[model samples]
Target: MLMRIILTALPFLSLATASKDTCEWPSWQDALTTCHGPPSTYTVKASNGKGLGLFSAHDLDVGEIVMRETPPLKISPPEIVKGSGYPMPAVTKLVRKEFDTLSSAVQDEIMSLTYHITSSKEATMDKLGIIFRTNAYNSGKDIGLFPKIARINHSCRPNASYYWSDKLNKRIVYATRKIKKGEEVYVSYIPLLLTQEGRQKLLDRYGFKCSCDACAQERAAQDVSDERRTTIQKAFADFEPQLTLEPPRTKKARQQARKNAKASLQLTELVHQEGLADYFAKAYRVAAISHARVKDWKVAAIWANKGYELKYIEDPDSPYTMEMHNLTSNFIANWESELQVGQ
Candidate 1:
């Protein structure tokens, strides 16, 4: 009876070990399953200028969740900082931990996996900092999940947006614009709708020269957009002093505030329509402020909510999202308070 029991257990143990062995380093398939089937219909292959990049295997629509991946290794912020100087030791430790946790087959797969490493002090620091700075997938947190999505190159006018869903325990990339078959999907590593100089500085920090269509066009349109945004901002600012001046609140000041607010909204909407979601938050904020000046709390709240939603879509727990939530809540509360006072 004992011998019979041991024979039965042997197959189960063998199967378990085999499962581990097969999953050693983990493939895209493994990550997909782990994340409950994120709408990833792409594969990574070598590209000429960019290193390995994700190419669409089929047509992908806007808002479609593309790659859903778990970090290969999740580390804390301190751990990341410690590993910054010489990460091989930390990498080895992490790899060993992963290997030990995984089945033998997975361990073998991981052992064979290749990682890009830098040896020089300047190069290594630069590389590590870039990784830290450009790492938008997880917001530079020490989360052990590295996804192929991180390798996607940047574009000023990006076709995709990434969101880290804590509920799903995975980082999800969504197409903000339609992607054609064989198109290389990209997301802006930095906010692109800023001034040309600001965008260029960010690109330089990321160690890449951006030649995206939007970047090219922005050189010509930069002055125009800046002038428009500045004019709108100034008009909005001018309304404040009028609001405090004298008793019977003049209609001219109110009208001017409304006009300024409307103009700002139009410019902001134009930016959004131009695929400048990166700057939508700021534009939305300007609209919200204008609406607030006109005492149109509803419109103010709505724009605030829109900005909140966009921030939530980009980064759920970001400071921007929290601010939006607070602003919206206060608006509602104040409205209700005013209603009670009138009654």
Candidate 2:
């Protein structure tokens, strides 16, 4: 079945190459021209043997969606690794089937991606399996192969972050902080909270050394950041119990709530300074809720407003975005008048 698809598309392959302009080579970066909704402010360039990378063409603000793309071929993990069931799934077979169904142009684009040839004696399915494993993003229960999004390289302290939009059936990458013109925008491919050594181990699996700013930091600085990250992780975990308790009924419960909120707020601030922009909007929301839980509406309103602004950047038209907006507006409308009354 897979061979049939490849054979069918083989005839159209020549047309795919014939359509390319000099700028659009067989190279991976040139494939950006084939992606959906890529911002003009970014350009594709060589990344010192990392192949093609996305770079800011001009100054970009925080919360800006740098690029948004819907994957032409998205497959679930179970499909990729179908175990022995009624019918066992074959990873390579499934991938090849999907690849064949794509337009010749699209097939060419997918073929141009940066991937390792895993085995000298590997079959076509085996090679495609390695490519998909290397480049696919986790989309809930499914694994998605996004051509353009896959181009953005890894960084431990990434300036941009990507989010999957169920509604759009697309993945959006946004700048978490100000990105200067010509600066390379990166996303942390692994867990942000991992220590340098841990992050290195993960990067090794992808066949490259991560020289991102965070990973390149001096030992002393890295240790300090790691310690703070560890503290943030532990502190947030401790606060989870109190946060889960339904509105503190007794004095002890109330006290514990306040303590938990305070600790969370502090830890979140450190997280922001450590260049973890992905968590900033979340941290602000946590702070707002903490203050509001104690009837500190004025402070809550302030934090909620900030959270709303940041949330809007991260996800426009999202239910969570609306919730943040509602939180800020309601808190402000209710508290602003009261504070003025006393004044």
Candidate 3:
């Protein structure tokens, strides 16, 4: 299957990149160029010892789509996850079964990705199995393989981020901030809210130790980043439950909601200071919901605007984007009504 969309997008809010970016997919037009060279703001080139990476061929804005590619390969995730959440879902057989179903052109695209073959005493899978394990991106219902997206490489602090677009049936890479030409676009392959040590533990799955700018900070600075991220993680754990579309039914619940919202707003400022631009649109959306929960429509509108500005750039024409836009343009009427959830 093949699909191609132009290299363009909505306006940005200085939200995505940090003088960096940048990273994926397949179509007839895309089958191989993504692995070799693709015509867009980015291209695939050797990324030193890290293998081939997607590089920005020209300067890109905070809002630009570095690349939007329909996947050449898609596979279902195992009905059951193994060990907390990980590998070995009959990889040897799964890849062989699915691999035979692909078009030769798609097969070539699949082959272009780098892989790390593993062997158990009883079985050793083919290269495609290793490739599938290493590169699959989670899209709703099924995971997919976007060879170019796989090549962008990892960083503790990535300048760009990738989102699975169910609406477009493609993976979109959008700048998290302004990125320079020739800069290697990075995305966080591990949890960004973990400390360096914690992130490294997870990066083990990828078979490399990250030495991104965030990881290379001096001892004192690194400790500071670790603390910030740890706090962010804890705050998120405490705050996520408070995010709701329903109105509070009792005075105690209303007071608790306000307290949680305020705490979340404080966390937002901390994330921005830590240069986690990827967290902003979502944090802002949480802020909006909090304010609206208290009937503070004016402030809620302000927060929704911030979210809409960045989310619009990351995902345009999606239903969520439309909902975000409505929250920004008609906060009182739209969100106020939504607050009636469960009532």
Number of the top-ranking candidate, with TM-score as the measure: 2
- Better-scoring candidate (lDDT), 1 or 3: 3
Candidate 1: tens digits of C-alpha lDDT, residues 261-322 = 78767857676656665566667766766776776666766676666656644554568778
Question: On a 0 to 100 scale, what is the lDDT of residue 282 in model 3?
Answer: 73
| lDDT of model 2 at position 141 | 60
In model 2, state the lDDT of residue 322.
82
The true-versus-predicted C-alpha distance at residue 18 of model 3, in Å, is: 29
lDDT of 3 by residue, 84-190 (tens): 45455565466667778888988898898877544463245466777887888788788788877888888888889878767668787878987888998998887
Return the TM-score for each candidate structure.
0.58, 0.78, 0.75
Per-model lDDT:
0.58, 0.71, 0.73
Q: What's the CA error at residue 105 for candidate 3, in Å?
A: 6.2
Poorly placed runs, candidate 3 (over 4 Å): 1-39, 81-91, 101-109, 117-123, 245-261, 317-319, 329-343
Candidate 2 lDDT by residue in tens digits, 1-343? 4333332433323333354333343322232232345555677889876789989877777756678878888775443324632111365566778888899998777777877554565445456667777788777566678887888998888899987877668888878888988999898888777678877887876878888888778999999988877776676666555443146789987897788667667967898878888777777777777777776776777777677767655665568878877777666655656666777
Question: Candidate 2 has what TM-score?
Answer: 0.78
Instruction: For model 3, give the 10-residue run with minimal summed lDDT.
Output: 1-10
Clashing residue pair totals per candidate (backbone < 3 A): 12, 0, 7
Error of 1 at 56 (Å): 3.6
Give per-model CA RMSD. Answer: 15.3, 14.2, 9.2
